[model samples]
Target chain A: MKPPVISAFEPPRRILMGPGPSDVYPQVLSAQAKPTVGHLDPLFIGMMDELKQLLQYAFQTRNEMTLAVSAPGSAGMETCFVNLLQPGDTVVVCRNGVFGERMRQNVERCGGQAVLVDNAWGEPVDPQKVEETLKTNPQARFLAFVHAETSTGALSDAATLCALARKYGCLSIVDAVTSLGGVELKVDEWGIDAIYSGSQKCLSCVPGLSPVSFSPAAVERIKQRTRPVQSWFLDQSLVMAYWGGGAKRSYHHTAPVNALYALHESLRVLAQEGLEQSWQRHQEMHQLLKQGLQALGLQFVVAEPYRLPQLNSIYIPSGVDDATVRQQLLRQYNLEIGAGLGDLAGKAWRIGLMGYGARRENIALCIKALEEVLA
Target chain B: MKPPVISAFEPPRRILMGPGPSDVYPQVLSAQAKPTVGHLDPLFIGMMDELKQLLQYAFQTRNEMTLAVSAPGSAGMETCFVNLLQPGDTVVVCRNGVFGERMRQNVERCGGQAVLVDNAWGEPVDPQKVEETLKTNPQARFLAFVHAETSTGALSDAATLCALARKYGCLSIVDAVTSLGGVELKVDEWGIDAIYSGSQKCLSCVPGLSPVSFSPAAVERIKQRTRPVQSWFLDQSLVMAYWGGGAKRSYHHTAPVNALYALHESLRVLAQEGLEQSWQRHQEMHQLLKQGLQALGLQFVVAEPYRLPQLNSIYIPSGVDDATVRQQLLRQYNLEIGAGLGDLAGKAWRIGLMGYGARRENIALCIKALEEVLA
Candidate 1:
């Protein structure tokens, strides 16, 4: 067979201000393209140590168990749920949008009961409602919620929720997939037990790696698991051996070396820019985007205080067609923005100002493109 | 915080003849380092479509549901088992090595009962035993086994196994992780239902992705699933949305774009080399390595006819310490060979000849190194 002649992969020059992945830095991309070192190589082990440190900084935790799960954000979610919860465990899941609902599904699949705290589609989880649910369901083992809900651009108060979980004697598993570098996630300060984040979101790395951290308490729970983690791949203890220190490491699945290189470079960039600066950059650009959308008579679906600055869920203009606008952006502007998901479908558009894409130029460009399309 | 400085990632030149991730091609590494585009970008969707087609060609199947799962080989195993087997489902699993035991665990985790057919650690799974197990457990929904047992460097007869599964009205879920590009796999011709392969093994891509294909029957099983797949990340139906056709792709988790780039390029290189040529290269190199090892008085752990040419499991030389030999190989020769796994540990050394690592030069070098160390 003639080698399937591929048209040279000439990626369009677009500012990726979508849900994810935000535009990766040139240095990070170059890092990804680097020669792959052996996963168990001594130099690679050093790199892993650096990566674990970077992840700890990004997640704002001193937890020694911080590492990148070798999969996407959803698999990161799976890693946390599968490792911590077991058959007959009761988890209080906050469902305001798509990711929260995903948590509910994960809980049920783990043979755990989900005591759902329902909220409106684009609204943040109400802590009072969660407290009431947790109090009523005293058996709840964990309080699971997305810190920055990607689908709806809603930001729940993670610290408050974690405190509530502690008050109820439940561990807190936070999903910071969208909030890792873009928002304030004080994992240690908040007393979060387990938290998972994505590389592609605010980190602006490539898409396959997910940075996860487990507090010592969460690690203790995993150590005390009655059942052998059902999924061999996501088992925390086995994974720790590969990522752990020492001359002799236990063998696990092959590590994604190149992806880790990219992630390491990305986290390096984050450290250089300063986490607070990155968060400020996201917020400022989001403000610029909000002003531009307002100039076009568009309104945000999420209320002011609770909305995630990185992901702005704005209502589609009355005369504008959602798919057509996205099509025009792709065809003419060569820009990619996300459409609203689930209940928000057709009614909203998710304009993301995340990481590298969280810039004045991208916001300005998106506004100009939207104006042309809406015209 | 000080910028997370990495001591420039310098990959030392090494001949990786181990179970996996065998030396990745320069082009594949470069591809992985490419700039990450958005997962849902038009350019990316085009790539995803191309990837699906490439996977179809690699698996030798016209199954529409062919794509890379965004995790390592173990997750690929979980995806197949969790999707195909529901609660109370009966599965006949053949356990000759570590990966086979993993399959049995997956079956049990999915609430499926596994009828295990056990064989010696360093031997191919006996088809007659599998047939007997299936006959005894006639209600088996699927027959699960490893095509390439990495732990033992043994290759089971996939064609015969699939035929037996068909005879018993059971679907076949084959672990082709180490066999896909290094050897021959005919998913359609052999009547396999679901198959999973790792990119790191012979595909010579980075480790994050698992290329998988599901036959129409397997797809049907998933569609008619009585209970939701226990894994939210590995759920095929939801995955299909992101990987599926034309203008209307579903919002799955963010893709690992750069890693997929590496996989697509690796597959492209495989196509360029011709699959038959790649398999031949592995075999020829294996022949050279086998002759050299035999000359050095090393004994093979597996029977010649049933051995996987890519992965050669040899008994550790008498009184030649396993740890010392492997460490010396790594430190001195910069060569990384695998230590024996599971029950075979301390007794065997698995030297691999796979993908870019499979060359007469590497074989000659490995033999020379082993001779010097053993002497």
Candidate 2:
């Protein structure tokens, strides 16, 4: 068979308002294009150090175990779960949306028993139910939950959940994939034992790397684990030897060099704006989108207080077809919005107001695009 | 503590002649700088189709399971192991160098017993030894080996190994991390059951993505597995839904969009040059490097036939400090070469002439740089 002749791939410029990969900053993209360097190059290692410090700022943590996982957010979630939970361990998993259910899968695949604390789709994980589950499963080693559920645009109270886990003498694993820069998450202050976030979502970076931080408590648990971490790629212990402090670093898996360059630029942008200010921008843009969406008679899936400002889930209008409207918007306006996933599929559309995508112009363009498509 | 203000990172221009991540083409780097798009965007998905076809050309395979994994090659290795091998299954793993040991780790982590068939570092796996091991462990479900061991620059007989696996009624999992684009590998003709390669090595793309292909037999094994794949992220079944055929793609994980762009361009460059030409160029450059290194009193670690032309592992001369020589090369000549890994560490240097890096000029420059540094 002859090889297919493929021309240079030139992707169309898009206005990404989807759940993730939300319009990476031009600087970040440019940074990504920087000349490739050896992963262990002195220059690259220096940049890695700065990248870690920048990640620390974005995660709002002073944890020494902070670094970007070489893979995506799903791998980051697995890293936390595989490192902390051993076989036959019991973990109280709060399932409110797609990511929470994914956490349960991680738990079960790691040979841990998942005692699910269920909540309505598009609702914050019920703190009361979590407490009860933890009380009943008193031997639970970990309490896992998604801080901001991207699928349903619901923001759970991570602070309260972490407190509950601490009170119950269990470590907490938090999925901050959608919450890192777009919401108020203080990994140190909120006492999150292990947290993972996507670089694409609210970090306005390319979609590959996952920034993760493990609190000292989480690190201690990993250290004490009797068995080796299941996934070698996601194993935090081995990875730390590469991303850990000090000038000399060990060879684990090859670090994603160019991607880290993009991440560093994104985190630097976040630091410049300040995490609190970035959060405010997301919230402000969400309000603008909310007013515009409300005018179109769209009802939000999650209640106002529990809603994630970065990911806004709204009901599909009565006569509008979900795919048709989204397709039309993409074709005509080059604007992309996420279709609902899992149980909310075809019933909702996710309009994102994430970092770099959270501009007034984007909000106006998305609303106008939807209006035109609907008409 | 306030976040440290970091300036834009400016990496020095260095001629990459390392074991992997050899000099990325200027066009590939430029492609990576293109505007970021949604991973599931129609345009991006269209690009993804072309990428799969391009990968098929590179791998010389028509297998429908060909796709670029979102993570690096290590994860790709894990993907093949976790998907095909169930608990208690025995795998005949050929341990010749660093990556072979990694394969054993993957097998053990997947709850499979790894029956080792050992060979010396810097030497290809002995096909007779592999056959003996397989005959002994008749229950072994798979035969795993690295086609090109990056640690010692030894090229194994993948065709012979695959044949041995087939003769024993076992699947073959081949690591082509350092072989793809640098050597002749006919995945279809050789009947490789599963294979994984890195973008960074001979593809001359960025380091993150892993291009993998599974034969129908391997896919069947994955489909027939009784237990769920241990990893949710690396599970090929879930990942296939996103990278598989058709216009519609399920959301598995956010792909490294920019990295894929780089891979597409690199593959396109490869196709234009043709695989045979790429391999010839590597061999030609290796010959040039060989003459130059011999003049400088350097000796190769591997014997003539088994040595990988792309990755030349040369013994460190007596009285020469390995790190000091490499550091001088980088500091003075702005050239990068790889230090030996695992058993070969401190005793050898891996000089690469991979995909875009395989040039007469690169060969000349690297040789000249090394000579000056040694002096």
Candidate 3:
């Protein structure tokens, strides 16, 4: 079998207003391409320490266990689950979107039972329903939900959810994949026990690394697990040995050196701009985008109060073919907006104003492009 | 909590001769820095198709299940195990070095029993011992071994081992993490049911992606499993839908778009160089390095017949501080060599000539640096 004669892939410079893989910060991309270094090099280890400090700030937690998982957000999600949920344990899982359903899958795969608190695709997880489920399932060891549901552009109330988990004596595991840099999340103040996020989302890095943080209580649970974590690669404890602040770090798996380099630069970019200010920018951009989308006659799937500012899920108009509009946007404008997933598939299109992608120019271009394409 | 005021990381260009993350090709690094794209973008999907085809060429197989795992080599190892090994299933695992032991760990974590076929750290798997073990453990459903022991510079007979597995009616799982592009490997011809390799190794790509291939038999085994794969993230069946050749790739997880770009470019580089030529280059470089090291009074860890050309593990001369020499080489010369792992720790040093790192200049620099540091 011969490899076909294929040319180098030169991706078009896209205006990415999609659910994620939002336009990367130029510095982050260039950082990854700078040079390759040995993962265990003293200088590289110094960089890893800085990376941990940055992750702690981004997650807003002083938890010593904060580090980026070497894989994507999905693996980060799995990391939290496999480390926390022992077999035969029950979890009160809130399912408002695709990520929530994924959480349920992680639970089942971990041999834990998922008692789902179902909500509409476009709505936030109802705290009352979650509390009721928690009351009913006293055996539940964990409460898991998505902070920002990228699938349907719904922003669930993570603070209230964490409080509910605390009240029920359950560890709070939050999926902050799309929420971290774009929303006001105080992991320490809110008492999030275990949290995971994506680099490509609000961090504006390439779509690979997942920044994750674990509170002391979450670490305690993991340490006390009788059975070993099923997936060795995603085992948080083993991973921590390499990413920890200590100088004498043991060899675990080979750290993804270049990806971590990119993450470091992206976090640096976020820090320079300030986290709250970044969140504010997303909100401001979202308001502008919302007005344009409204004037263009596209109805938003998520309600105003429950909406995620970074991810705006709008209805595909009555006659719009889902594929045609997305394809046209890609080919004609060199733009990319996400087609819907799960229940919202074919009915909604998600426009993102995430991290570095949250700019007035991007919003204006997106509106102009949509208006022209629709016309 | 605020992110520390850290300046941008500028990695020094070192000549990497480490056991695994050998010097990455500059084009591969620049390729990753290319503009970001949506995971489901038509152009990105086309690139993924090309990537799979190139992987097939590298592995010398026509397996439809050929694709890159989104994480590093460790996750790739887990993917092969969790998908194929069911609970209570038995596997005859040959442990020649660090990776083989990891295979045993994977088998155990998957709720399967691993029958050990232990070999010395610096030697290849003894086929006679493996056959005897298989004969004794008739219930052994799988045979797993490391094709190239990166830790000890031993290249096992994968073809002979795979043949033995076939004769015993057991599926063969090979860890080619260090062998892929630097040595001879034939997936279809050897009847290997499953294999995984790292990008950072001989492929000269950055250290995250792991290219994996599964024969029809392995795929069939996964489909027939009664127990769910322990990892939702590493589940090969679910992952296949995203990387499969079908035009409509369902969203399993957001593909690492930029990392895939790097992988495609690296694999393209391999294809253009021709697989056999790349292997021969590593062999030639190894002979040159051996001559230089022998002249420098260094001793090879593995015997000539069983040695791996890409990874050369040599004894650290007694009375020399292991850390001082390595540190000196790194600080003074900007050259990276590997510290021995596991059993060989403090006794051996692994110098790699892998993929893009297998050049005359690297060998020369490595020898000169070692001489200066040792003196």
Candidate 4:
């Protein structure tokens, strides 16, 4: 048989300000295109060390077990749950949106019980309710919640929740997927045990890596687990042998070399901007977007106190078709805004100001394009 | 506290011929650096359609469920098990190397009962033993095994195992992580119900993606399940809403847009090479490496009849320290080869000749480096 011919792949260029996959910085793109190196090469180890250091700075934790997980944010979530909770362990998980529901699933699959603390979509996980749940489930091993709920543009109070977990003698597993660079997340000060964040959200890297940190208590649980971790790939114990501090890196599955290169460069950019500056930039852009949306007579889906600056969720104006407006925005304006998911679908739109997307120019352009579409 | 300073990153060149993450093609590298786009953009949807078609060709399967899982190969494994087996389903899993052990873990984690068929490390799974286990565990719903054991460089008879599954009226889940683009993998012809392979292996794309395909039977099982998939991210039913057939795409999590671009380009490269031609090249390179290793007095760890041509596992010479030799190979020649894993660690070395690494030059260089290290 003759070989199949490959057609040219030319991706249409567009400004990304969606819930995730925020734009890529030029230098990060270049870094992604760098020559491939063996995962265990000496210089690659040096690069790993540098990556770990940068992640520490970004996460604001001295947790020695910090590194990029080989997969996406979902995989990072799975890693935390699988490594920490053994079969039959009870966990207090707060659910306000999509990610919280995912945590419940991870808990169940790990053979652990999820004592779900429910809240309305687009609302923050109430720390009072979380505390009540922990009291109810006195033997719970951990409390898992999303600091920034990407599906609904709601930001939970991470420090308060971590404190609640601490009071109950439970570990805290925080999902910082959309909050890492866009908000203040101090893993050490907040007493977060395990936190996982996505690179594409505000780090401006391509979406393949998830930077994660595990506090000593979480690592202790992994080490003390009775059964071996169910998933070998996500097992923290074995993965640490390969990704942990050392020149003699053991073989895990081949590390995603080029993707890590992109992440390394992305973290470099965050370091240059400084986390506080990046967080402030996201907030500033959100303000600009909020003003524009209010001018157009749109209301925010999340309350002001709980709204995430990086992810702006708003109600679709009356008399406008949801799908049609988003489609037109993409086709004519070359702009992408996320549609609401689950209960909010068809009623709201999620306009993201995150990472490279959280820029003054992008906010103005999105507002202009949205206004034109709505008109 | 002062944030870490951002330093310019420049990747050094090296030859990666270890178990996986072989030298990436320049085009694939550049593809990863392409501009980001929304996961649900019309153009990206079109590209995703093309990617599914390309994956179908690569896997030699007509399964419409062919697509890349958003996470890495481990997540891909989870997707297969979670979709096919409901809780308490009996599964017969064969374990000869590390990946096989991983499959067993996935089976157990998914609430499936795992009836393990154990084989020694660096040995191919014996079909007779698998048949015997199936006879003993007559209630087994599926048979799972690795096609190319990355850890031990052993090649099992996927065709025979799949045929056995058919004969016994059971489904088959095959792990073709190191075999897909480097060896013969006929999913349709072999009657494989579900299969998952890694991008960083023979495909030579950046990691963080797992290309997976499911036959009609597997899809039916997924649809008929009494319980919802425990993993929302990996639930094929929900994922299908996003990656399945239709002009209208649904939203799941954000797609790793640039990573898909790289994967599509790598598949195109594989198609251009022609599957048969690529398989032949792997064989030829293996022949060269075998001759050189024999000359260097290195004996094969796996039997000749069952050895994987792409992953060459050979016993380390007595008195030569495994770590020192591997380090020297990396430091002096800038060549990377894998040390043995699992039970074979410190006893053997695995020299991979996969995809771009399956060249005469790389084989000769690896041999020369080995000879020098031994001297």
The best candidate by lDDT is 3
| Candidate 3 runs further than 4 Å off | none
In the range B1-375, model 1's lDDT, one tens digit per residue, is: 344555546567677888888888888877776666777777789988888777887888899989999998888998999888878999998999999998988888777899899999878888889888888887888999999999999999999999999999999999999999889888999999999999988988878899999999999989998788888898889988889846577777777788888889889888878878888888888888889999999999999999889999999978788988888988999889988999999999899888898888888889999999999
For model 2, residues A151-236, the per-residue Cα lDDT tens digits are 99999999999999999999999999999899998988889999999999999999998999999988888899888888888888
CA lDDT of B210 in candidate 1?
A: 93
Q: Which candidate is the best by DockQ?
A: 3
User: Model 4: runs farther than 4 Å from truth?
Assistant: A1-6, A87-89, A132-141, B111-113, B116-120, B227-230, B295-297, B371-375
Chain A only: list TM-scores of all candidates: 0.98, 0.99, 0.99, 0.98
- Candidate 2: clashing pairs of residues: none
Candidate 2 at A93: error in angstroms?
0.7
Q: Give the whole-model CA lDDT for all candidates, comma-separated.
A: 0.87, 0.91, 0.92, 0.87
lDDT of 2 by residue, B71-148 (tens): 999998998999998999999999999999999999999888999999999899999999989998989989999999
Model 3 scores what on Cα lDDT? 0.92
Interface RMSD of 1: 2.3
lDDT for each residue of candidate 4 in B1-375, tens digit (9 for 90 to 100): 568875766766778878877878789998888888888778888888888878998999889999999777877888899888898999999999989998888888777899999999888899999999988888999999999999998899999999998888899999999999888899999999999999888888877789999999999999899877766567888888889847777766667888899999999998888898989999988999999999999999999998899999889889999989998988898888887888888998888898888889898899899888899
DockQ value for model 1: 0.55
lDDT of 1 at A374: 90
Q: State how far residue A200 of model 3 sits from its true place (Å).
A: 0.7
Every candidate's DockQ is 0.55, 0.82, 0.85, 0.53
Query: B1-375 in candidate 3: lDDT tens per residue?
Result: 866799999999998998868888889998999999999888898898888889999999999999999999999999899999999999999998999999999999999999999999999999999999999999999999999999899999999999999999999999999999999999999999999999999999999989899999999999898888888888888888888847889999888888888899999999999998999999999999999999999999999999999999999998999888899899989999999999999999999999999999999999998988888
lDDT of 4 at A359: 87
